[model samples]
Target: MMKKADVGDKTKTFHKGQAIYKEGQSSGEAYIITQGAVGLYRLAGNKRVTLALLRPGQIFGEMGVITGEKRTSEALALDYTEVIVLDQTLLHTLLLKSPRPVQIITSYLVERVRALNALVPERSSSNTFASVCSVILLAWRAAARSGPKSEAAQISTVELSRTIKDILLITQTEIDEVLEKLARVHIVDIVDVKGTYYRTDPLLGTKKKSGEFVKERLLSIPDAERFARVSRNMAQDNPDANGAELEFIDLDDFARAVDAQPETILKKIAYGEVPPALFHFHKRQALAFAASKGQDYFQRAKRPRLKVEDLQNVDDVVGVDNATLEEALSRLGFYKVGVLAALAGDEARQKIYANLSKKIASVVREEVQRMPEPDPGEASDIEDELIGLIKSIKGISG
Candidate 1:
């Protein structure tokens, strides 16, 4: 019969309903409940699924200790309980004293479980900061495997993309979006490495010259875990289950909105730095982007194709009788005013000269910068669309 053992290093008492450990936390030692009960649970969507309840003489947390894995379940003190803590050293010693065949079989089983875990589909989070944290940890593990170079770890986007997708529900495009933001925030550097890898064709596989994206970081990791926690808790900020909340920009207000220019944003998207999924673009460019990706990137941002609303914000409207100003904003019926905002780069600021009050123009310019741009070949198509919109606005308003 199983019996409670006092061989463990120390003992402690936990009040009822106290958390002994949470899921996804680092594990080192195992616990034995000498008194009271403990419960193991996990979060499945919004529901908590209880896995087990343990009482005296039962040992728990051995799996995490055996595999050096994160705690897969939350252990709560089901009642006021006395527990014994068995540290890593004692666990290692105990394992060493096990029978030879038992040791061999246990090691093999542990290895098998780890290998199978990769085949399981799981989503840790879709939060940008959390994704960033996960990437850093994954990169460190990969770098350690290859023997890290210098004080930092380096990893190609390709391998990092593959590993992240295997474990999380995120996609390649999503990963790229997170990496670009991380680079902008100075947490990581995106370097273009010129190289040749075998390219397979219908007939033959040959070496091809191309640029590989690699994310490199300094040896330091600061507040990554803490930031991830904050982001995860704030994941509810994303409303309605869309990948990201879509923000709209009215092109008729483009000129008034600090001459709204999307060139920089477009270049980033066309070059694949920003995911096309974030933007709303019409014309053949939008169709082509959807066709190339086998998905509707523009569908995320829903906006009216044509607006002919009567201007009704009598209290908010600042009197402006000038034809250009009227055409830029009054006719469009969207006068979200605030004008000191700027886009990401210097090039973006030049296209925007505010006619819509200093404060409103700045804010509009920032939104325009937030909008997407297109490739050189696709640029003419979108530019033509913009020209047509400008022409229609002028002709109709008159």
Candidate 2:
């Protein structure tokens, strides 16, 4: 029988299929699987892939909780299970007081390390060091992000992979494959203990850190020069605009508008430092330049996408009864239905019948019947046409 002290803490119960904790959340405590089972999984590519399953007597989350790291994989209860929660502080204190506890923890950590080594391929001596460096760099960034708050100075593999994918413009699989190759050379250490953490020697070959390597690659792009030139030209043209104006140019205006700046604007621009052309800025160069330099420029504001809540309000106003408007909004994408419903008073609905087509209008009419009768100003025809537009756009059955 397990002693109360050996359990070290109280057991928490979870139903089958319930989430014990999600991936990416901060690790609060580790768990000992006292009864039932739990499955650990992470998002691999587009799918949730199971990394491991724990049965009775096995401990999980020790690596991350002890190290104060973010969870890499989600833990889901495989059945009605009871888990003994081991608070990091309390566990550490207990471990210090008891030789038996220290031994247990040491054995657990060793077993975990051994298990990870068996699962991951060993790094070889013959592999390209450059690729190995890249993998190590990514792994370092990931560990930095996922490490504890005190060591919060770390990055997680997911974040590192995302940055590399964006900078290198490669898929996750491509990044994973590169890491796998580097893992073969032992240049990068990939550990599957708790959340996957990576470690690498930055001084292995290159003097440059991973960040410097990525920055160098970015600066070397052919478009980098062109983007810089265009941005400088735009800045010169908008000499009157303040630095903030240049920095916060709206997307639409940034692409097309060009106009002279006022004296006051020029004074502000003089005080402001020119911002660097980063990846996102480079992608929207035309927009950024236009907003900075174009005369009579107006940046188009992005409209909020319509949501289910919008449809519910429309249903309340229109006298549509019976069917829940929320359900209808889901069937017809919210924005599509909301934009059409907004046209309830338009004159075009009545005159544009033949142009709009009957099938489209019929669906709109059916939906409107659920809502309350429109006010005197509301035109049923316009509402019908709006529905028609939605059906046409979504290819929904009229």
Candidate 3:
């Protein structure tokens, strides 16, 4: 019987055939087999393809641990085993804290790779076409994860070739050959001259839209009506509903309440009718759905109505101090005494003058453009008068 040595730090016992780590899972830690054997394998051709077997004093999962790559193989314990699990975070800290550990890890990985190569020769030539196909499939999955469905499903062979070449250090000719084999097997549907491939059927190699593929394609539509309907429905089902309820506001009610032009709301909703079941219609859902349609239902509903008191308040003018008035006028651009007097009388003076100033700025800009240079004397007089008018408006003699 082999004596089991206790590697006290980060060691855990696993039952026979128990999964230690799975492929494609986030690599949070690396493991060193201490007391038992472990098998590394990947799913290939619907069969478990054994990649390697590890005994005591062997390090595995370093590829993903170092590069932050996804795990490429599943590790299963051969029997009751004790393994040392090193935390990736701690490992990184250790690498930074001491250079020696980093050097040791790097050399260890190199030695492991060389040893593995002696057993399994780099997988460069064996079934090169199949490997290429695998690369394409990986690319497709990656694109689907990152981009819109329609974009992901309709990948060009040229693009796939470029990506494969970059990632796998393979030739375009090899990628092309693999693509042809993939197309021949019907794992991917190839569009002639366009180089587009769609995963039609997984097993029979039939070209068919996957559920996710269908959903993604539908969502990619500029105006997805199904999404809108579902969104609207979802909004209506909520109990603590704000503004007008969705059920209360029918198609006609929505149009009238919003005061939109004839057929505008109807036409917008009509465009979203293609996949009605796909969306959950709710308030937020409706808003998001109608966003592309340029409808502002919530904004219209939330618009506060002006009252008589509000108007009266604007008309009622209270005397403002000269310094305050002068500063406001200087910053805001008011020149004529008459204009200031009119503004002072109106309680909505700020609002009115703001609008007037905008117009004045536009006119001044045009005049400046027409004139080669402004008259210094005229400019000085205008400035003085502007200041005086501001002071007077505020009822200050200065």
Best by TM-score: 2
Model 3 per-residue lDDT tens digits across residues 162-233: 655543445767666555544453446565542334575768978864333212211011222332343334
Model 1 stretches with alpha carbons more than 4 Å out? 1-6, 108-398
Q: Write the per-residue lDDT of candidate 1 for residues 241-328, one digit (tens) a residue.
A: 2122112332222323555354444334443556655555434535765688775664585422222222222111122223533354
TM-score for each of the candidates: 0.30, 0.31, 0.27
Candidate 2 overall lDDT versus native: 0.50
Q: Give the runs in model 3 whose Cα sits over 4 Å from its true position.
A: 1-8, 93-398
- Lowest lDDT sum, 10 consecutive residues, model 2, at 212-221
Global lDDT scores for all candidate models: 0.53, 0.50, 0.52
The residue-level lDDT of candidate 3 at 97 comes to 71
**Which model, 2 or 3, shows the larger lDDT?**
3
lDDT of 3: 0.52
Candidate 2 is scored at a TM of: 0.31
* Model 3 clash number: 19
